[model samples]
Structure formats: structure tokens, C-alpha cells
Target: MRLRNKPWAKDKLDQYPQYVISGPELLKGKWNGVFDKVQPIHIEIGTGRGRFVTEMAKANPEINYLGIEVQQSVIVTALDRLIEAELPNIKLLNVNAGDVTEFFEKGEVERIYLNFSDPWPKSRHAKRRLTYKTFLKQYEEILINQGEIHFKTDNQGLFEYSLKSFSEYGLLLQYVSLDLHNSNFEGNIMTEYEEKFSKKGHRIFRSEVKYR
Candidate 1:
């Protein structure tokens, strides 16, 4: 679902700096000040439309959740929904995932979520994949030793590639699921994409990757 250019998206986000950090660089290593307390940070990289992250924040009040999305149009919808919820532990970042380190300090994030991310199926575009080794290294820099990545996708090819990428990077795989819906996994949160694909009978793949 490609979004049209919403010229007002940026301004809309600007209206709420507390919920949406417009200039994330200024708050580098100072994210704790935003929430006024030190808490485990969990971010969903590519949080499309904000369904999963918002629900997670509502369900888990103790952990701070950040939803990072490059598209302002997409995030605009999320901001509207989050503001209505008035959640204190959730914030949205209108920044690219590649520059994630510039916003959070090392060992600052406890969990990273990659839900229904772009597969970047082209052979030449492998580097753009979020689970690519390069991106994994970037995540490694911010995630604590015990931190883990929770990833799910409707694309089997991407799932296989991510599994191999994680293994090659010396990360341990836990709770790997080939059919998430039938696996009866506890605490499973469905993204908008996940629900759409699953209803069409697409098998949802999921995995948890952590430092070895």
C-alpha cells in the first residue's frame, strides 16, 4: 500500500514533540529524559500504520516502545492513533532505520521488532534488507547483551534469508516458527499486514534472534 505524499505529515508530527520526536539527533543518548525515567526500550523498525507497536505499548506499560518509520504519511496515521490513546510510554520516530544509532546510545535498546518489513527481494538490493548482516551489526551496537530481535514476515523467501543472515552473524535463533498462527505462540501480536496475509492463508514466519 504505497502512500501519497502527505505534505502536512511533518507539521502534524511537529505538533506533538513529546509523542513524536521530530529531530531525533538532538535527543541522542537522552531518550530517558523524554519519558523522565530509565526503562527498557523496545522499538519496532518499519512499524507500518502502528498497529503492533501501539498495542504493545498499551499492553506493556513498564517498557518504553518506539516506532521508527521513514514515511511520514504512514507515521501520521500512527501519531493520530497514539495521541488518541494518550500512551505515556510510546514515542514515534520519523527517521530511517539505517541511522538508528544516531538516536539511541549503545546498549540502550532491549528489544527490536521487525514486523512485515520490506523484503528487498532483488538480488542487488540485499543490503537494504533490515535483517542483512550490516543492519544486524548496527542493531548489535545498540542492543544489550541479552537483548533480542523479534521478527515476523509473510514472505517465506525473506524469512529464509533472514534466518541464514542471523546464523551467519553468529546469532542464536529461538522460538522459530514456520506457521505462527498454528504454532499457538503466546503473546503473538498481529500487524495489519500479518492479518491481511494470514486471512489469505499465507503462513506467517517468526523468529527470535539473540547474541550467541
Candidate 2:
């Protein structure tokens, strides 16, 4: 779950995220200005190296995209991608996923993407997973009703765990795919991990969960 220790992220991560908001203060009952009037926003948590987020932003100019990555090196790469692509619609933030609610006002996010999030494979580490009950609640407060979460990964255990987590939270799961490339879903945006795993002969897993 820690990207700080990675060599690639160590030398290049930007400590101060541009186009960043600090925390939930923006969305609390007493807040004003910031997130209240922005266009529809979509968030990508753990956007490594910015491949997918950059492409998504390039492809979808009407909607704003925010990508957060804890690894400074990765986020630097993300910034580079944005800069090179000349994508004005995308923003990069270097931060952990745990403080999602702290960063935005309530009902500010329209959708969320948990692309290849860390599995946190150990049982005791369940709380660290992004789809944990607590994180889901955070998402609920920030996401509009029927706000959706789009997740994709090559990890089976994590996918199964997330599936259960989504169900327990009463979020409806649709477009579940145990094998992504095998599925008929079109326009699948593949992240760095997705490309790596897909080439390894591993079947990618994907699912869409919507809050009622």
C-alpha cells in the first residue's frame, strides 16, 4: 500500500500537488466557493504514471478529471503526461487515498476510479483497502446519489474482496467481469498495470458499482 518506498517514485514525486485541494473542509456544511460549482468531476485514485488518467482526460474534455497518486515519482510522470499531452482538463495530486473525504466537499465527485488499487492482501489489512466500509462511506458522502465507482484490476483476491465490500454497502454491482479482455465491454481504458497484467496472460477483472 506504500508507494513511498518505491525507487521510481522516490526521486521524482512532487510534494506539493498542483490543482490540489487539501481536505473535507471544502465540502463540510459551512463551506463555500471551491468544489460547489465546478463541472462534473471524475476522480482516479492511485493513478500510477498517469497513463490512463491522461488518456481519459484527453478523450473526455467536457468533464474534469483529478488523479491522485502517493508516489512522488509516479505523480511526476503523471504531470509530465498532462504537460506533454496539453490536457487542460486534468489535474494531478500526490496524496494517499485514505484522506479522500478531506480533499473535497460533499457531493463534489461524480464518479471514482480505483484502477489497480493495492490489494492489501493480508486479512488484518482490510481497512487499508480503498473499498473498505469506511472508504465507501466517504465515497457516499462525496458522490451524488447513483454516483458510480468504476474499478478494474488483475488481482482476483482483491476483486472478490471488493465485490463483497460493494454488496455489503448496498451498492449495486453491474458489468462485472472476471476476465476483462474476454468481456464485450468496449472502450476499456487500460492503465499501466492493466497493460502489464494483460500481457502476462492474467485475466483482468472489472466491475461497476452504483449507489442507489
Candidate 3:
């Protein structure tokens, strides 16, 4: 799906510096200082429209949530949700996921969330997938020892590939569900994509992998 460019999105994002952080790299290891309360940090990469992260923040007040999205238009929608939610534990990052390491120091993050990320199905583009080894290595760098990555997707191929990738990277798979909504998993917040796909009878695959 092509994202329509919003010419005024940048200005809107600038207006809410408290919600959408700027120059995140400057904060690096000092992320806790910016939040209302210093707490375990969990980040959602490709946090489209902010549904999952915002809901997560509302559900878990003790943990700070960061929603990262590269596109200004997409993230602007998330900013709107943040503005309405007015949750003190959530912040947004309008930056590329590839540069995540630049904004976080080693062991700065306790958890990472990947939800319905672009599959990048072609073999040549495998490296671009968020679950690819390259990206996993980046996650490993900033994540605390035994930090967990919770991933969800409707694409079976990507799920299978990610399982192999996570295992090969030596992450211990603590949980796996081929059909998440039907499983016993509780408190599962649905992303916009997840809701749409599941309504169409798509099976949502989920996994929890820990870097030990």
C-alpha cells in the first residue's frame, strides 16, 4: 500500500515535540530522563498509526513506550492518537528503524515489538526485512540481556523465515502461536493491519524470542 504524502505532516509533528521526539540520537542512553517516570523501555518498530504502542502504554503504565515510524504521514496519524490518548508513558520517533542503534545504547531497551512489518519477499531484499539477521543484530546490541522481541504478522512465509532467522541468531523461542487470536494468549493488542487481516480470515502468527 502506497502512503499518501501529507505536505503539512512535518509541521504537525514539530508542533508536538513532547509526543514526537526530535534528534533522538542526542538522548541515546538518557531516554529515561525524558519520560515522566523512569521505567523499562519497550519499542515498537514500524508503529503504524500508533494503535499497538499507544494501547500498550495505556495497559502498562509502569513501562515507557516508544513508537518508531519512518514516514511523516504515517507517524502523523500516530501523533494524533497520542495527542488524544494523552498518555505520559508513550513517545513517538519519526526516524528510520535502521538507525535504531544510534538512538539507543547497549542494554537500553527491555523489549522490541515487530508487528506486520513489510515482508520484503524477494531474496535480494531479504536483508531489509526487520527479522533478518542484520536487523536482529542491531536489536541484540541495544536490548538488555534476555530482552525479548514479540513479533506478529499475517504473512506465513515471513513468519517461517523469521522463525529460522531468530533460531539461527541463537534467540530462545519462548512462545509461538500460528493462530494468535484463537490461542490462549491474553491481552493481545491488535494493530490496524492485524485487525484487517484477521477479519479476512488470515491467521496471525506470533512469537516471543529472547536474547539470552
Per-candidate TM vs. native? 0.96, 0.86, 0.99
Q: What overall lDDT goes with each candidate model? A: 0.90, 0.80, 0.96
Query: Which has the higher lDDT value, candidate number 1 or candidate number 2?
Result: 1
TM-score for candidate 1, residues paired by index: 0.96
Per-residue lDDT of 1-212 in model 1, one digit per residue for the tens?
76789898888989988788878888778777788557889999998789999999989999999999999989999998898899999999988878678887888899999999899999999999999988998899888886899999999999999999999999998879999999978988889999999999999999998975
Top-TM-score structure, candidate number? 3
**Which is superior by TM-score, 1 or 3?**
3
Total clashing pairs for each candidate: 0, 7, 0
Off by over 4 Å in 2: 1-38
lDDT of 2: 0.80
Sort by lDDT, best first: 3, 1, 2
